[model samples]
Structures are given as C-alpha cells and as structure tokens.
Target: MANPTFWVAVALFIFIGLLYYYGVPGNVGKQLDSRGKRIADELAEAKRLREDAEKLLKEFEAKRAAAEREAAEIVSNAKEEAERLASEAQEKMADFVKRRTASAEAKIAQAEAQASAEVRAAAVDAAIKASESVLRQEITGNAASSLVSQGLNDVRAKLQ
Candidate 1:
C-alpha cells in the first residue's frame, strides 16, 4: 500500500476513466466518419466530371467527322465543275476554228473566181487586137474595111 509505483498506476487508471466519461472517443469516431463521407463525395464528383469530359469528346469527334465529309463533297463538286468548264471551252474553241477555216476557204474561192475572170478578159482583148492587125495586113480598101467591121462585130458578140 505504501509503494510509489502502485500510486502511479492508480493515477493512470483514473485519467483513462475521466476521458471515457467525457465521450472523447465518440467525438473522434464521428470526425473520422465525417472525413470519410467527404472523401467519398469528392470521388463521386470526380467520376461525374470524367464522364462529362468523355461525352464532350465524343460530340466533338462526331462534329469533326461531319465537317470532313462536307469538305470532301465541296471538293468533289469543284472538280466536276472544273472538268465541265474545260470541256465546254474546248468545244467552243473547236467551233470557232471550224467557222474561221470555212470563212477563209470561201474568201480564197472568191479570189480565184475573180482572178480567172480577169485572165479571160485579158486573153480576149489580146486575141481581138491580134486579129485586127492581121486582117488589116491581109485585106485591101473599102471592101476590106466593110469585111473587117463585120468580122469584128461578130467576134465581139460571140466573146461577150
């Protein structure tokens, strides 16, 4: 009963009993539970945010695909238009060339006809002069003049 160790042990037991009576363990347990609940809520919020991000990613991907398709369609239409225009231009050029060639040929034919007429007129004039000179040399006086005139008249009528 007089030992110092025995008195120290008794004091420790009394301190433990006071703490229990005041509900300190219960308060610690409540705080731990609240902390755990807070951690769970934060985890749940993080998962929801991740799900929203994935949804947004999928939506953006879909939009990108649609835009690509539209762009391809535009390019295809442009190519077709360019080809059509090229063909039309070629056709127009061919038509123009044909028309020009035909016009040139017609002009050449007209020039040839005019040249032929001029040459024939010149030859007739030369033949008439030669005949007149020969007839004057071969024939004599009044009878010769009358015969020459008649022959000249006949040649002029026939040639014209």
Candidate 2:
C-alpha cells in the first residue's frame, strides 16, 4: 500500500473516523431529505408554469376568434353600405334619364303645336287671295254667284 493507493486509503480512514465521532449518517439523511424537498418544489413550479402557459394560449385563441368575428361584421357592414350607395346612384341616374326624356317630349309637343298654327294661317291667306282673283276676273252677276259658291266650298274643305 505504499503506492498512490496508500493516499486513497489514508483519506478513507480519516473520513470514517470523523463520521463515527460526529454522527455523519444523520447529517447525510438530513441532506438527502432537503434535496428531495427541493426537487419536489422544482417539479411543482414546472407544473404551475405549464398551466399558466396553457391559460395564456386559451386567451390568445379567444382573442383571435373575437377579432375574426369583428372583422367579418365590419366587412358585412361595408358590403351593405356599398350596395346601398350603388342603389342610390342607380336611382338617381334613372330619374335623370326620365326627366330628360320628359323635357324632350315637351319640346317636341310645342314644336308640333307651332307648326299646326302656322299651316292654318297660311291656308286662310291662300283662300282669301283666290277669292279676290276670282272677283276681279268675273263681273257678270251669275259668274259672281258661281265664284262665291266655289269660295265657300274651298273654305269648308280647308276647315274640314
């Protein structure tokens, strides 16, 4: 035992003699108990952290769902607003077209009335000139009588 092993043997003798005099077995048992308690606390802390993480995940999912619902509602509202605006624009356009058409019709009616009045005035003027020519050409009483009959017939036909 005079080799390197002699030193290891000498250290072990010192350790055993110190344990016998100081009740080192009880100290070892106390150290092991404290280590076990520390291990148990670490496991409990790990479990608590896991539960907190799960709760946070649930909260995040709930918030995401709420945001999605809100976004959908907003989109729906926007679509409705767009449709309403489109409908209003279409209605205004239709009304504008109707008004323009009515105005054009009114102008056409006024033009037709003016044309008819002018035609009637021209017809009366022509009839009066023909009567004057006949009176100047025919002087006999019977010729005058035939002229009056023809003039009356022309006026009646024009009136009809």
RMSD of each: 4.3, 6.3
Question: Which pairs clash inside model 1?
Answer: none
Alpha carbon deviation, residue 19, candidate 1 (Å): 6.4
Query: What digit string (tens of lDDT, one per residue) describes model 1 on residues 1-160?
Result: 7999999999999988888999888888999999999999999999999999999999999999999999999999999999999999999999999999999999999999989878877887788889988999999899998999899888878886
* Model 1 error, position 93 (Å): 1.5
lDDT of each: 0.92, 0.87
For candidate 2, list the clashing residue pairs, or say none.
none
| Span of 10 residues, lowest total lDDT, candidate 1 | 116-125
| Residue 122 in model 1: lDDT | 81
Best by lDDT: 1
**Residues 1-160 of candidate 2: C-alpha lDDT, one tens digit per residue:** 6787988999999999899779888888889999999999999999999999999999999999999999999999999999999999999999999999999999999999888877887887676668657765665577777777787778767774
Quote the positional error of residue 35 for candidate 2 in Å: 5.5
| Residue 143 displacement in candidate 1 (angstroms) | 9.5
Model 1 misplaced stretches (Cα beyond 4 Å): 1-31, 135-160
